[model samples]
Target: MKKSMTMMLLLLVAMFCNAQMQDPVKFTAQLKTGNTAEGEIVFSGKIQKGWHVYSTNLGSDGPIEASFHVDKKDGVELVGKLTPRGKEISEMDPMFGMKLRYFEHSVQFVQKVKFTKPTYSIKCYLEFGACNEEMCMPPTQVELNKQGKSPAVDGEAAKEEEAKEEAVAITDTAAVAVTDSAAAAAPAALDTAEVKKLWTPVIDELNDYDQPVSNSLFYIFLAGIVGGLVALFTPCVWPIIPMTVSFFLKRNKSRKKAIREAIIYGVSIVVIYVALGLVVSMLFGASALNALSTNAVFNIAFCLMLVVFAASFFGAFEITLPSSWSNKMDQKSEETSGLLSIFLMAFTLSLVSFSCTGPIIGFLLVAVASEGSIVAPTIGMLGFAIALAVPFALFAMFPTLLKSAPKSGGWMNVLKVTLGFVELAFALKFLSVADLAYGWHILDRETFLALWIALFTLLGLYLLGLFNFPHDDEGRRTNVPQFFLALASLAFAFYMIPGLWGAPLKAVSAFAPPMNTQDFNLYKNEVHPRFTDYEAGMAAARLEGKPVMVDFTGFGCVNCRKMEAAVWTDAKVADLLNQKYVLISLFVDDKTPLPEQIEVTDTDGSKRTLRTVGDKWSYLQRYKFGSNTQPMYILIDNEGKPLTGSRSYDEDISEYMDFLNAGLDAYANR
Candidate 1:
């Protein structure tokens, strides 16, 4: 229950953080004119601190430059390019491989125009990209309007008219304050009910919300096929293949009729399993199942359930549905006539095999449900049913094939035992999730790795016939498959031993807890780049006469870890980063709170408070570079000018080397 509450709290915190990181720039525009037909128009931008707006004349290689357009009027003529009037920061952007100009804090742009008529009105708009230190938003446009009249001819009156014009311009600009008015009218307080609604984190199904349903279905279907194949080797379902096919042959003497009935039986199995999937989907909606995936209570329950299943496979106890259900179906199979009887017989097989297939099916369902797809369960069941039914149908069609099949015996139990070990190992992953979310520190990286190593080692010994379980035969010789599996298991167990000392085991990195969770480490003394504060890194780069490599990373970023393990570990890339550049890794997902909270009005005029270190870095990314994606690598010179094109999550070492060398060359030449 405590873990469950922790999970809910974590999700709510994530949602709140996401909401606060939105719309980093605000804009307002006005027409500045004196008592003349000619006047200048100014566009003012009030950007969030740490965020930046691109200059109108930024190069094509960088982000989209800020630009403006004035609607053509009968007498109004636009005279010069929009000129930025503020502190324009110039830097060579590594992401774009060119120099770019941008503004932080606030900026105003002026455009001179002439009106032929005494009175004129003009409509205009400006387009610009707003970025912070971490990420970039898409370019957006803000519209503006100006209405004016010619000044009086008298000198004193003209001066008064100019004053009036200035006052009217200020009022007109204030009228166009799109952000301020909406912010003012917004509810000052949110009700508890409304807060509850906001607390629900909106999971984007898979990683991409735009992913097609068919793609998800296809992947789950493949998973089902793999599961069915594993289930086929288990003791419960394998032995029945011959017995069921013989019954079909005995009932129908005619070959053609027997084949047709066998196909019907296979189709029946498919329908039954698919129907079961449909029933599950109907009982708990997809959204609920998706939520269950991250629910701490559900994960704990699932972990316990898997433990029970692993014990069952290890011959501790059997998990079975009520005998009445299978008995009723068996009676119907015997009483019903022809096609209906065959279908009932298939249903009976499913029920009788439930003890073994049930665990596998249940495990599969739990895995698929987490994907948040409506049809994934059905598709998965369809695939599993198809794989299970194929052998039964084929053997019935050709009884000769049954004789060629290996006899089911002690080897089947070995397969079960191996799977039992696997299940026990995977159960730890769920526990680790709860541990990480709650900061319980119960199952740290070394402890989890130790448990897995022990489990696989025991499994390998059992496979080699060194130990006997209740179900294992006393004097059976190890078969070829068994020998190889045992060897593989032992090898895998040995491979994980190094991970205890902080080796980034790339293969199992996804399953293991993060490296930082480890209490002890031997690999910490390597000559890696320093991941210090951003300002300090820039200062170091300037003092040392070297470039700076800014790594926009996240603690929770899987790809970032992968890149560190794979590409950055390469000798050349590592050398360049450690020796030639001052590196600073800014973690966008860091949850550490700031010393004091700072509130800023967002681009939409909505208020956002930066209370955490991550929030600050996220704002920095969006404010400076206009990008939010992680594993973003940028190289800059002492003057804070970018040295080369930026790199993202590519694992190709050659490409990374090139990126590093290009930056080094650019810095040297500069």
Candidate 2:
């Protein structure tokens, strides 16, 4: 137990502490002459323990693959491409949710180039991503050349001798991984001083980041409040509203004392949630929260947990904590005299209501964590607790109100069963994210749609008294609420039927599989990007005297598809984008090979090789715009300067329009 605690503490520190940039691989460059004029530049890297560099050609959705850059492309003619020689390790990695090819230990990268003269000068470098189990470092570069005369002809013997001594899998880090997740941006390399000569710091041109201010924290707090309000109506909580009234009313029949105690009870609930928030803060900072949503393992775990919670709601089994735990808290509440006693009572309430509350809490945490805020968990819980406490206080002040409240009975069970169906629906969405990330293709558009259709259709039938679960009343007729819900459910199910044939079910597009996943998408009204290349798009935007909407997206990105289907499809939005702006849709995960490799120097003078179309766009987002996530939309002027702040994956049409209009206003003003 001590060891477990120590390990957990270490993990927490490693995850929560602000980490400094550290380079895991050190590279040494040597020039070998196969007769002075023609030979290879051998770059060797000594990889630190627990870190590995990814190999070339690993898909874009995975870690940034190893590649080389010939900085002085015109200075020397290339004999062939750079080659990695090592014991390459290939495996499925849950971190990035893709198959990865990486080299561990020490790996060697070889670049063969031909010199125009007997004595020549050239420069080149290697780039790769270095990652271990806990975290990933940003893309790192190591210089492989220093301009000078080619060395004399005796290199084969020296090269062979060094090759025998230095052989292991090695590369370095690439800006953690394009996730930039609910994946945190990889830590930058600390060896800034070492690569100073070859690197140029890039910040001078990137106008001070004017990202649109976000009110997401307020929203998260509101969501928590809403969740707490919903919990009060659950089977486990609703029946207690009047019981609380009875207990407070019986307290010496003293209205003043009872109201004070009830107020203390509300404070206790806030304290409990605030304490929970503190624990989350200590364990998970912003980046860790990001990982909770983006990391495949976390998502999969959440998916499975939600499924189990859904089953519990459906009466498959009850979810409960140890009875002793709650009993102990109850005992403490009774034994104590003041605030501690009230707090203990609230704790008991929380424990007792875990079944109904747990699922709702899970949903809230997942949503907020995806937003990647360090304080989200605590703030969210605070909001939830406040909502839960409001009724308790109200009932205490006037104990008669809850006396007329509907009792918990078959109605509560109906509500629980209905929530079960909704939970089941959400479970599939989580599972679908893992499927897309892993390229499993198990839950394609049609498959996902079919499953949802079936689930909702059954839900409608159940609501209409066509069937029942174990806990539900055997023959209860459809009530007003259930009948209306059934109408909505059946209508929703039928609405999705058209989606199977590719009707672009914009209503559920944010939740459904992307149209590209559908084998048969017959929907016709679509907005096509004028250009996929950033530079070309910007150039055209300049020629057309139009502002640009740079859409940093990915093929595997669900939110990207959601925006395209939902927000972008709005008639006004489509018209504005089509007429007012030049749209550049850069797919960060596009694996299409570029015509030829392009070597781009990063601001830090570190070299990056854009080997594929995706690499180029991904690099542009990372370096130029200072972003890496997909479904990122930024409005920029013809000069490549952002007209306003960038917009990400919020599907609020009016807000999105406001964003566009703001950009246009900025453009016109400029």
Query: After superposing candidate 1, which stretches have Cα over 4 Å from the reference?
Result: 1-219, 525-670
**Whole-model Cα lDDT of every candidate shown, in order:** 0.67, 0.69
Measured by TM-score, the strongest candidate is: 2
Residues 115-170, model 2: lDDT tens digits: 56434566666766665543444455566554444434334543453345332223
lDDT of 1 by residue, 57-122 (tens): 765444557877654555578887889889998864322435678898989888888767666668
Q: Looking at candidate 2, what is the lDDT of residue 332? A: 91
TM-scores, all models, native as reference: 0.58, 0.71
For residue 324, give model 1's deviation from the true position in Å: 1.5
